[model samples]
Target chain A: MYVYLYDTFISEAKFQNTIARVETRLTDLGIAGKICRLSVLTSIEELVNDAVKNGAETIVAVGNDETVSKVIPLIADHKVSFGIIPIGKPSRLAQLLGIPEGDKACDVLSARVVTKLDLGKANQHYFLSRLEIPAGEYEIQLNGQYTARSLNPNQTITIYNFDSLAPGVVADRSNPRDGQLELIFSGGESAGLGRFFNKDSATESVFPIKKAQIQGLNQDQSVIADGYTIINTPVNVGVARSRLKMIVGKSRGF
Target chain B: MFTKDEKNSSESETIIGPSVQVEGNFNGEGNIIVEGQVSGSLKTKGDLRIGTNAKIKADIEARNIFNAGEIRGSTVIAKDKIELTKTAKVNSNVKASVISIEAGAIINGKVNMSQEAAEESQPLELQDKKEKNNRK
Candidate 1:
């Protein structure tokens, strides 16, 4: 059975209209499911747990990137497969998953093509996209054996679980399911005539690590994971042991 | 003379400009050009070019290395070749399959061009090693 989780933050009128259209489409496609609304009192974890107890085989999120991020860790190691029907602006995760917005997303749900993907964890929270760290000097210990230090305060560190985030930055070694995280450090000024002309040129250094400990930060530094500020500096980031079974559109690219 | 063709033939995947300073372990798969200062180790599958103004204080391993700057400490190992321009001032052990040094370049360490050097320049399999050994 498929259970739909709808975000209640959207306007009630628009939410009802969207659900009406989506339900009609699902009915036409012969897909049976129940839609559950998320509110202040009902936490996402509670709703997911209830759905699982009531025999929900697939839990589809009908909201934006935040909704998807909230639902991933809840259903990560469970037997239920996850789906998405993006409904808000800035639905980059939906686009990355190749799920169309609105009524088309219903078709994707009905199609039900599933694949396993890796999840990145910082502390207790899980993220499917990437983490953006501000420019700073950091001491990185990789897999407990190799240690590296970054002295440039202008360099930005990014840890990616998948290749969906950071457009134009080419990561040739990024594989989402390969059980490794890609760490990219980019900084420096433009060279020669470009610098004279005020061009933005920088250097990018890439590394593939299984587990990393990042130190050398002030206590107040915040780390942004999936567009949300989750924790402060001196954090540990790595690929989770569990994989997420995700339903994607046919054109889904890693 | 290093021709323009030689400089532009292989595009650098990563470029470090003159104003930046990096002190970390860098591992990647693309060619890199460093015009700034790096104080740690660098590992890449592609070629590495140290520009004339670059100052390096780390061990480096790459497929090919073209140096025209100042390097100190550790060893510079390349699988294919290591070329030092006239402005290059290197003060470390050098190892490669082929080594070329300009007449005006200053070198203050041993240079080894042999098959063993080429094998040592290959990508390290650190994931399988049991003990921690720093490359100095």
Candidate 2:
């Protein structure tokens, strides 16, 4: 199967750099001939139309969170599989997808295993991070640094260094049957500095939501979906079961 | 506050090496130098220097921007100064309060300074606003 590479962000030169690196890596892995790229499509609609017309089976989105967000909704309606190569800052979605930074990203492009993963929806849009309804603003001290900001409702919050809590948090909140959104409120003076500091699941949230429909969240609420901001308030969020066909890293284990 | 071995090591001034990447946004105030790769937005209140081989793809808000390497995104420098050295290669829009392009430096995109700032906002800046507006 041929892999279609898409560079949707600005800066064509950087896109060229990404293409060069991707091509080189694919060549090293003996798959260069299977890749094709179509950049500068004027708009996202054109980009997707071109991809479908090109007869591409899989789409590898290069760049960061914003780029991934642009394509997720489009591919969800189709049968094409999608992958990501994180090359921008705040690549929360890419980090969640298990993509490495820099040159190692090329290696990820070459290695692919397909799997079905859960997706979240807020109104008409799809999200890939933890959703926060009644979106409370919180600050986190990351790697000894502090980030003070309010989180938006229906946004995806990517959790790092909180691996122990991921499963419990996801299980309690994310429910395909109930159609509810999952949420976990956490953070402190430092990364891993939590209420359960002594316990193994200190940083994890045991609460899960199978289905949740929130109302009265204001009309203009802001949300961070995999680091991409969406400010559509008073929106309905629910779990979309097996909504995404992902070209995951071999070690992702679904 | 330096020992004998530490003093000797400082004298050689081994650069901050290369290939290392910072994957998150950063902010600071000082004469900082980056030698490897930085993949995020940076906001500095003082001089921001990029080393000869560094690769930075960021939306930078800083003072006294000096580049001797490659920048793949937009730069917004609010006053102080800006210098693109002989080996610099910038591929995107640059909106500086001040700018200096040395011999051999290459920029493939538009250069937006005090004059062009009104005409064009940086790509990353526009993207930020768009996302913010979408939330509204």
Candidate 3:
């Protein structure tokens, strides 16, 4: 059974046509199921719990990255296959998954090209992308053995599960299925004209880690997950679940 | 059912780019390329490349080492080979199966090759006995 969870913003009148077209296409493909709108009255956890109890084998997020990130932990816990029908703009997760926007996403979901991916968990929140934290405020201890700190205090340290967080940034070393995360430390000093002067300076440093602890976070420093949620530190992050089954298109970026 | 582009092949390699300073023991299971400052120690089971702009002050161990930087440490051990490029300035006791030093590279410490080190690893009393037997 497929149960679609639409984000609250989709309830606006501007998205009516897109939602209708998506439903029509889903019905035509014989993959249509119950659709639930996210609202302030009903909590997402309760809805997901009910869907699981009602025999929802596949839980699909019919919204954006924030919507998908919210339900990832529940889907992984229930051990159900997940799908996404990206609708609105800034659908970076869908772009990375190779799923097109609007009704076209229904085709990818119906095709059922499932792949298991690792999820990055910081504290309790599960994130599919990466964790970007301000550098020098924290020290990351990798695999509980060695520790790494920023030599430069003004940079940002990003622990990437999927490497495509920053578009056109193109640091392609992180593999989501390998059960390890890539800790990328890039100094902001080499941004505009500094790159010209520092010809020999390396722009990025990559570290592969199985487990890590971000310690020494102050009250002001926050770990941003997927560019939306502010995950508080000190953070304990690793592969919370290594086998998150999802429907992915052929052109998906791993 | 999905076949994403597998263009990026997996390489177990670490890059310590320039303008970064790393302290403590930096250990890896694969190849490592250093272009920065590593103060404590650097060890890897695979090949190690010290880039031209790198300034490392750490004891090093690896399978094969290619140094083109500055290393001021105690010991550098390589299981297979060690190649010092023209810009390398090393101050450590180096040991390897095979060693290559390029022009303009400066070495300020003792170097022990595989053959002499193999003989030196034997018990001293046994080595003296062997020397006596060889004289006869």
Please list all clashing residue pairs in model 1, or write none if there are none.
none
Worst window of 10 by summed lDDT in candidate 2 chain A: A198-207
- Residue A80, model 2, lDDT: 79
What are the Cα lDDT values of the candidates? 0.76, 0.55, 0.81
Write candidate 3's Cα lDDT for B1-136 as tens digits.
0011123112435766676667778888987777778888889898888888888888999999999999999999999999999899999999998889999999999998898768988999999999999999
Candidate 1 is graded, for docking, as incorrect
The order of the candidates by TM-score, greatest first, is 3, 1, 2
Kindly list the per-residue Cα lDDT of model 3 for residues A1-254, writing each as its tens digit.
99999999998899999999999999999999998888999899999999999999999998888888788867777778999998787688888888888999899988899988998888888888888885547777877766666666656788888856463233467777888888876765656887789754435667777788987656666788877788777889888646688899887887
| Worst 10-residue lDDT window, candidate 1 chain A | A164-173
Number of backbone clashes in candidate 1? 0
Tell me candidate 2's TM-score on chain B.
0.67
Docking category for candidate 2? incorrect
Query: What DockQ does model 3 achieve?
Result: 0.42
Clashes of 2: 15
The candidate that wins on DockQ is 3
Ranking of predictions according to DockQ: 3, 1, 2
Q: How many backbone clashes does candidate 3 have?
A: 0
